[model samples]
Target: MKPKLLTLSLVSAITPITLLAEDVTTLPTITVEGERLPEPGISREKPEDMVGTPADAGDFLRDIPGVSGTRMGGHGIDPIIRGQSQTQLNILLDGAYVHGGCPNRMDPPTAYSPVETYDSVTVIKGSQTVIYGGGGSGGTVLFERKTPRLTEDKFIRGQVGGGYTTNSGTKELFGDVTAGSTQGFARGIIEYRDADNYEDGSGNETRSAHTSQTGNLILGYTPNDKTRLELGLEANRTEDVLYSGAGMDSPQADNDTIRLKYENQWGTKADVYYSDVEHVMDNYSLRSLTAPMKMRVPSKSKTQGGRISHNLLMDNEMEWTMGFDYQHNNRDANRFAGPPNMPTPTMLQSIMWPDVDLTQIGMFGEMQMPVRDIHILKMGLRYDRVTSEANRAGQAAMGGVTPNRLYQQYYGKNADVVDENNIGGFI
Candidate 1:
């Protein structure tokens, strides 16, 4: 079954009625207007052109139509597009995927993406294409950086800036630099942000504070004008993040990513990436020790993916794109509890994520043809194979109870490996 959403708003206007000696002759007609209809297809915009400074990709996406976000804390705002969120939406960072380590979604994909570091952000609403992957029923968001072109006249380019928000005492500093000749170029970026708890308009304080730092480097080799190869490395670290909406505060959340990409003038492209994330959250580290016992959870996630595609143009002005993509994700998390004021907790409270692994492989083909004057037709077909397994489902945890046993007790189902094959198409 598909999910649905409904929203309603009410507005009231009070106007004084004036009494006059003469009788009323005519009354003016009133018309009410609603929001404009969303436009179809893709929307791309330069990050520098965006109004105001955005803390992360989620803040940047709020400017786009049909996009909204849920604020978790001072940082990490989860984005929702066209009422679709989480796994239903495909979020990509320079053709790579980064999964958050927090099981409660304190750190979504967008949380790691620094808006100013990228050249452009693209949003494709709805199921517009199949080349990006499968199950993006809601939409897709791509944060992309462009390759730098250097010449003898202008061999260096970059930007450095900083901003501050008074209400929250939020401070940010960022820098981007690139240098090289026509054959190759090297780029580097660094960003740092620190924020304190903020107060609402009514002067109520919210427990939202965080500190984050990010570093990225890219080396591009352009042997010829038609061919380009690039390697990218990135790291993000967040510490002492406090959240008002969640039970625990994050002490450390870190991410590391590496990617390689190749493209040619012939419309051939290839990309491969690997990402790792580590997250730690505890109730005592950043907040008062109100509970009788100290609780903490540490989780880790890893993702590896690649894609290869080619575009072809026919004599009839029709375009065809075909591609294959594969992705594998692994996650493990554990919760621990001990007496209050205990620095290190050894007791195993629960197996939050019992070493789960998910893999998906997909192949897709799409065609766009010009039918006649002012008319066009597009179609696409995709097939995907998915496999999932919990390697430690039977491992004992918390009173010698296994995850599989808990699953059986709660849902009355066996925790066994599963596989699925899916086919999707659009016209």
Candidate 2:
């Protein structure tokens, strides 16, 4: 026996967070399993909570009980959020409705919202929050940056990391540097994302790979413990080649987005926010070089909006949130023949997406009641006012065909001051 007492070796391989979670933590107000705080009120946590990217954010929300959204390219999943699309759910960025020019759903709202930038995402399942404006007509999603904690003294901290995707064989880099003092703080970040098209596990191309870039600047000042002020400017840009299953020729496309926001909270975290967003799509193009002839489908669209919200932390524990917003859309479209349809040399009409403009304002409110730490009762109300305009030649102004006036037509049948509501519970 080789000195039985001398032959002793101990090796430990434990992650920092794992070790932390194992010790000295009995009750955590907000568990950071990496942004996965499940339905806390009677709603246990789930795996979908941790999917971080914008492309995957909706998947998490959809998997939540009583929630679902449409899927495309295996990414940019747009949630139905209780049977609602587009304008129904108020998918907000810094509290403003962000609208992209792509009518084909190629680049959904989240496309302009690079998910990695936000610290936390809150989904108001139904008409739970009053401030989401037009998009929230369906529901409201709040993607917010983490506010710096009011520590006793000055401190400096930061995190940096990168990842690689097997599907697209793409590499991405993103992170942040945070420096602070007792009075205030500032942080900034730049992210570059690019990847060739990804092939599904079956080795079949998904036609969903694109290059994306985002940059954000954040500033904050907490003069005192009860008051916090925050300002942030963010941008998301992406480009890709669209390959339609029906069309042979591929069309290259691009989108540009900008968002600015200011937020402040009163006593006990009563939230107030004001934000503005601008989005521009260079052009939505598709190939016309088909069996019939050579052609080109080309168009351009732009949208801009502003929004505001105020929250009241009532004694009843009804986390009440309310707000308003407006949006404008401008479009121009045409079909140019260089390939197919050349025989008659068909002229792409502007009718498909006519020159349509709309402005919407709405008021909404929501409150939740916690029942025995096992049941959650939530209710909401919303009132919307819309103003629509179709230029006599709004179509001609943008070289479009006859006016489509989609929402306007719907409102024509339904009228302004639309009333919308939502109710649900999870235990």
Candidate 3:
């Protein structure tokens, strides 16, 4: 009986194996195609598609490879890329340059950039081209807006979004709308953000509270399928910005920008822009006074720039571009002192930035040729004439010493006027 039971068990197992071997299936072959790789040392992103909500351009940049930021407070992060920062990195907003008003860099250029409004952000990690501007040894950042396309069926489009962060009590609201026909279009964008002091893992609160608002409008006219003209106006205001790493808090930081652009299918492009900034910082506005006298600093900066370029495509598939650009930046800052309980500062303590001006005019040419299916040969040349001046360098300060005299005493060089000629290229 035991031998018969064993034989039956073995037959059952063998029967199941035979049935499985007889049953067979086939699957169709599949092929997947991924996106093409981007050019070397260049990265681009769409703000709306980013993983998380970023407070500003600097905050968004920190998420990129080889990029980091200096956190001052709840907002206004200063971006650092590959161990270089500040003037080494050139930042452009819709092809316009916006210089910050804070001398200590509490409000770097990225601070004025509202991430939600821009369509695209491009980062060039190294000196790869000579078209944007000069002295970008570290890299260049471009925040750009694309032309809105509308048809007879879809003449209007818009989007709105809001978010909240529980840990930091941060609230954000942003929206944009576009209305157009086949001939013209008008677009508007608005954003608001508010944040309170945040706590760390230990539940200790940090000094980082701020409020910001931004608005922008763009009008575009498409004369034909190949030509377009656009005008843009933008404003940004921030208040009661607290900083833990600094001695003062920014009570007001405002920016206004205007730009006009022209483009055609012939690869011709031209743009002119102007940006103005006003920043005010005080020791008593958002925090308790630590010194005997209250201190405040008010600063202003203005930047005007323009560029024109034309691209030529050869029969051999090579592209050549030639352009000229000019920029002028002016800045002034003053410090004031008063009693701790004073409602407003009264005494002029010092002339921190005494009407400084920097101007640059440059001409550049570049050519790109395909070296095969996978490689490209690129080269460029640029020349710039820069002029710098301290208009009020002889003005008296708190200690009755002139800024020019201090410069002479410290560096043994005159600070009144300086000029430089720079020539650069890349391969």
- Best candidate according to TM-score: 3
Which lDDT tens digits does candidate 2 get at residues 1-427?
Answer: 5565345321133456677877884765875557544553222223224544334456556656667777555445577766877767767665544555445555456665655666766776654445455345456777667656546564677766666777676767777777787677787867777766677678877665556677777777877665666666666666554333324222333444455545555422323332222222222233233244444444555666665666677777767665555555565444444343234335543344444456555565666777676676766666666666544333431353334344456555422332334333222
Q: Clashes in each model (backbone N, CA, C under 3 Å)?
A: 0, 24, 0
- Candidate 1, superposed: residue stretches over 4 Å from native: 1-39
Question: How would you encode candidate 3's per-residue C-alpha lDDT over 1-427 as one tens digit per residue?
Answer: 9999999999998998999989987879989999999998899999988876676899999988988889788788888888889998989999999999998898999999989999999999878888899988889999999866778899999999988888789999999999989899999999999999989999999889899999999999986777889999999999999999899999999999999999999999999999999999999978889989999999999999999999999999999999999999999999989997788887878888989999999999999999989999999999999999998888987778777777889999767588999999899
Q: Which residue pairs in model 1 clash with each other?
A: none
Per-model RMSD to reference: 14.8, 13.0, 7.3
Off by over 4 Å in 3: 1-32
Q: What local lDDT score does residue 314 receive in model 2, on the 0 to 100 scale?
A: 74
Error of 3 at 137 (Å): 0.9
Q: Candidate 3: deviation at residue 241, Å? A: 0.2
Clashes of 1: 0
- lDDT leaderboard ranking: 3, 1, 2
TM-score of each: 0.89, 0.67, 0.92
Q: Measured by TM-score, how close is model 1 to the native structure?
A: 0.89
| lDDT pick, better of 1 and 2 | 1
Model 1 Cα lDDT, one tens digit per residue, 142-248: 99988667888998998999888888899989999999999999999999999999999999999888999999999999877878899999999999999999899
Assess each prediction's global lDDT (C-alpha) against the native. 0.90, 0.55, 0.92
Q: Pick the candidate with the highest lDDT.
A: 3
